[model samples]
Target: MADVRIIGLDIAKSVFQLHGVDDAGATVLQKRLTRARLLPFFEKLPPCLIGVEACATSHFWARELTKLGHEVKLMPAQYVKPYVKRQKNDMADAEAIAEAVTRPSMRFVGPKSPDEQSAMMLHKVRLMLTRQLIMITNATRAHMAEFGLIAPVGRGGVDRLLAIIDDQTDERIPAQARSCLQMLVAQLRLVKLQILDNDRQVLTLARSTELGRRLMEVPGIGPLVASALVACVPDPSMFRCGRNMAAWLGLVPKQNSSGGKERLGSITKAGNRYLRQMLFAGAMAVIRRAMQGTRRTWLIRLLERRKPKVAAMALANKNARIAWAMMMSGEGYREPMAIAA
Candidate 1:
């Protein structure tokens, strides 16, 4: 235990696999422990670097281990995958984590605090509720269309749908059918109210933080985007630069270069999908306004040569970079001076 300098922990609900190595990179320990005994084992061992693949419970474990005086680092699961020797079981995965954590260039994910995690949970719940509402709304509309009752496009269209449910006098929909759909309508109303309540809470929380205010100052980052980013990312400094943050959100293009020839395709579209979508949607809003306004700068020039959607993505990449800078410097976003292309 005294010689163990690194421990790779592959965590599960009931069982955990651990692989430990000494300072000279020699395997010193490979062990499994039940949930009850895991913490006590760590509590008894000497302080060392503990590496875990980031997952649902990794943050909780990382927080717990940190309090016990052990230095804990988290690496992404994808980055650790290449090091798996042969078989892909718990022990082999733990060993891979052990090896990957020692690499000089390996990137680590910062452990999120309880409050930060809670805030992220709020955004996720809101997203889920919003999605459910859309699904129900669409399904209700489709079903009503079958009865020859159609509503116009847009959100206001739902009102006609609800109206049909309320109108028992309308012969188009049978009473039994109306009763069945009214239940769904009730559910739809309930979800909308829940979403509204969540939005209010998130807005209040966003106002409580200086970081959130600064984040909102960036073009296209509304209260929702600002709040979501603030909650999801505890430390912007984890990224070396703005571009790195954007890349982490997968806003950058995918590359395929061979024989010194560079080939770039669509954006990677990896990492935080919510953040990527929010940033891109925000960019679309910005581009829409830019088109109407008199600002004929970089974005306008880019739009002249590229498609609108392409311009939106480029703007999203730039805004992500800007947001990263703002978070790091504790400053509001300032439009950069455009240089000759």
Candidate 2:
């Protein structure tokens, strides 16, 4: 009712709860609205600061609220948790959101655009399908091994098995067993086809986007990585620096400090799991090729001393930092200096 200074919205699928505070931090309004009524209610309110927990559908509302002349801040759910008082309820959560948004040091999630969210959803679906395909392939191989049939270990093995099943002269395999293998082979083929199609779609989308095109210049970043980066990070400027970006990607080591002594552990492994996995895979690929070359660069030399897995992770960390620099500076990848001979 009074001049609204801040409004904390606890959003849900159908019902939404709002807690409003005035400029003096006194409670001004508390109301509930259905999903359909949410926007209309905000449109009537004078332009004020609105805060919401970063979750499903939050971005959509953030964009909508922004368009209605309200300043929107999306706080990560974890950051809001500390501010929650004794009992956790809609009101409490709303209050926590209000408190969290006001903190100067609070890190907020940049609201993603609809297209960015769509791209991310597509990547998630592709990842699920790829996992299913791997499970099916493994299951088929394990099942065949029980019947004295040894399938090869990789994709080539799947093709070989299918070829064997198709062969008329393969009398070694029982007729019924061959029939089952035939069915599995058909399914495997379909899964592979789907995977390829999804990959192509992702690649096409990445090539068409500006950010994706820029990300592609990085050695290990292919179409998938480029597109994933574009989908995951809505605003590159949100990261203060390259290191911040790397830390956000969970590529940096975790730190523990006590008595003025600092201890560092393995990477935090926080943030987008899919992007982290892709970066690690890319790192592995780069390491494999670098090993074959005679160039004794700093990274290559480091790889020689550390375990392959450790080296791979180190490269991933470096790549993450490089990615951040590229994204933030709007520049392409540049080769680092080599140690003087």
Candidate 3:
């Protein structure tokens, strides 16, 4: 094992496969270890380079292995897929990771700290609760519409529907149906409260870190977006530039360029979907405000030439780049000069 210079670990809940290579790029170790045996084996092994595919628990293992003096590199699974040489299996995947890690051009994902992971978990729970809230609201609306009861839309409309459900004198909804719908209403209200609580926590997280506070100064990046970015991305220096960071978020256009001809399609929509979605939503909000404000910003100009959705995407991409720059430079966002309408 002393001859081993690099190792690729294919980790699972119970069993793990390892592929180790020597300085000469020859296989030195191929072994399988159970969850209980995994750490002890590594603890005994001398310090070496370890590569792992990023997944749910990859960061946890990476942190643990690093504590044992191993240099751990977390690579995106998609990037490691091309290195597979044969039929897919845990062993093959481990071998592929071992090979990929030594490549000069390979990309690596930064392992997230426990606190960052905790923040991401908070965001995930809030997202789940928000989805539940939407589901309950839709179910309530559907049930009420069956009895000729209709409301406009949004929270105010939902509240109006709830009011009708509560009115005992209203003959539109039968008592039995009203009781069932009230149950949905109660769930909806509870979810809203839970989401509000999540928002407060996210706000606190955003204020806790200097980087988070700087991120919030960017247009369209509220407490939620800022917090997620801080949690998901621990090292901004991994990206060479703002555009690379934007590309990492999959905001760049997909290209089909060959020869000298260039053909670009829609945004790749890869990387962290939550971050992309958050940025797009924030861009829409910014566009809405820009439309009402007296400033003639770049987004407003884009809106004149392209559809609103297209413009929103462009704005999202720009915001991602801006956010990356802010994170890298340790600087606050500066408002660009805009012409008066």
Candidate 4:
């Protein structure tokens, strides 16, 4: 047990599978420990390298394990999948994690701190409330439209419809519809307030640091993007280049090459979906403004040939690269110079 140099841990809510290999790459320990016994077992073991798959609770365990004088590496689940030998089981997964973490070229996910997780939870809650608002708003609008009461198609329109519902003598909508919509309207108001609160919190966090301010200087990055980036990424140095960071967010194109011929397709759509969604939203804001002018941006040039949606994606990719570069360089965004006439 003392000579075991590397252990792969398959973490779970209750039982944890541990596969420990000796210095010569020989299996020395294959054990399953209950949740309560897990930490004490490691506490008695000498300092060594521990490998685990990066999943739910993996970061918490990794953070805890690190405090035990052990070096821990969290491998992405996809990267470890190839190592699973025969039948799939907790032991096989644990062994696979052990093998994958030993590979020289394997990429590992860094464990996120408690604060990072908390901020992500905030973003998640905000998104959930926004979705609920959309559902109720759409249902109310559709239901009211059935009774010959129709309005415009935005939140503004929803507010107008709510006003109509509140009016007792509006004969267009039946009383039953008014009753049903009243509940939805109340829920909508509550959700709107909650969303506003989340936005204010994000904005406050963004302005709390000079780093966030610098990030916001980048085009297409607002308070939400700036704050989310700060909370999620603690070290930009993990990526070798700006494009690497962009690619990690699934902004870069996916590729398939054969016989030295390169074929590129849609983006892999991997990595953090929330960050990607935020970047795409920011890009759309820029595109909305660009539509009003004939001013040729690099984006405008692309828009001339590619579709507006494609152009928007290209701009989002560029913004991701730019944002990463700014984070790495600690420099504020500099406006691009006009192309030589």
Return the TM-score for candidate 2, rounded to 2 decimals.
0.91
Which model, 3 or 4, shows the larger TM-score?
Answer: 3
Give lDDT tens digits, candidate 3, residues 1-341.
89999999999999999999999999999999999999999999999999999997999999999999999999999999999987999999999999999999999999988899999999999989989988898898888888888899878999899999889898888889988988887888889899999899999999999999999998899999999999888898899988888898898899999999999999998899998999999999988888888766677788889988888888888988888888888888888863232
List TM-scores for all candidates, in order. Answer: 0.96, 0.91, 0.95, 0.94
Q: Which stretches of candidate 2 lie over 4 Å from their true place?
A: 164-184, 337-341
- Taking the candidates one at a time, how many backbone clashes does each contain? 0, 0, 0, 0
Q: List the pairs of residues colliding in candidate 4.
A: none
State candidate 4's TM-score. Answer: 0.94
TM-score of 1: 0.96
Candidate 1, position 1, lDDT:
82
In terms of lDDT, which candidate is stronger, 2 or 4? Answer: 4
Regions more than 4 Å wrong, model 4: 171-177, 338-341
Tell me the lDDT of model 3 at 150: 85
* CA lDDT of each prediction against the hidden true structure: 0.91, 0.85, 0.91, 0.88
Q: Give the best candidate by lDDT.
A: 3
Q: Residues 264-332, candidate 2: write the lDDT tens digits.
A: 998899888899999989988888888889889776889868987788888877777777777778777
- lDDT for each residue of candidate 1 in 1-341, tens digit (9 for 90 to 100): 89999999999999999999999999999999999999999999999999999987999999999999999999999999999998899999999999999999999999999998888888899999989999999989988998988899988889978987888788889888888899899999999999999999889878789999888888889888888888877899899998999999998889999999999999998788988898889999988888898878788999889998999999888888888888889877665663232
**Cα shift from native, residue 160, model 4 (Å):** 2.2
